[model samples]
Target: FRQIVVEFLRPPTHSDEQIRSMKAKANFPTDIGRRLRFENAFCRAWDLNLPPQQQHDVRQHILSYMLVFTTASRMRGIHPDGAPGLFDHTYEDNQVVWKPAPEDAAGMPAQAYGMQNGSADRAMGCLLV
Candidate 1:
């Protein structure tokens, strides 16, 4: 499980040859969106197949670091004036313009954007345990 998390957090390489040389098959997908969807499905399946106690433990671990994940997700882009880095952006009238999220209004789902109120309250309950 630690290795799974580590691999997920690792930065992607630019060279296709480098990605192909990696032992983990999960890194083979070049498309970021497709790779994310695949990894999400993989994690969901793994969690579902685990025993009840193990599943609970996994959820606890995730909840424990919810704040870190939330902060990282919310701050995942480069400054418009700074180098674009990994994120794709465009120039508008000689000014940098970061791409918008898929849903301009609500943005992504609560889980993707970090925990919602109900989930945060639930996490607090777990922490109190």
Candidate 2:
């Protein structure tokens, strides 16, 4: 599962034109289309011999992994200054600095897809089950 996730996140060898074509045909963003492709590949490779229950469980695990991966990626985009260490602690006059506002901290990942109010957490909860 970890190997699958790593492979999915690996840089695609497709040229820019090929990627644009894929995104256009999928009628969605490139990242989303790529995720769907990876999901299908995972299903093909692993779902063939598994019992139904195990298949569902493995699928959920992969979904949860993808959610966390993409959420972290979005957060990094929104807070590039924290890219080196998202939770890095710094003190200024004995007070912690660099804290993100609640909305800023929670909103970016959710808002990336027009979701609101910590929907990322709800999505992860569902996927983890």
> What tens digits encode model 1's per-residue C-alpha lDDT throughout 1-129?
121222335443224453333313221221212012223311221211111112111011111111112111112222223222323322122121222323211221221221112121112111110
- In model 1, what is the error at residue 20, expressed in angstroms? 1.7
Stretches off by above 4 angstroms in model 2 are 1-11, 28-65, 69-129
**Candidate number of the best TM-score:** 2
Model 1 TM-score (2 dp):
0.17
lDDT of 2 by residue, 46-65 (tens): 21111111211101111112
Where does candidate 2 have its weakest 10-residue lDDT segment?
A: 55-64
CA displacement after TM-score superposition, residue 71 of candidate 1 (Å): 8.5
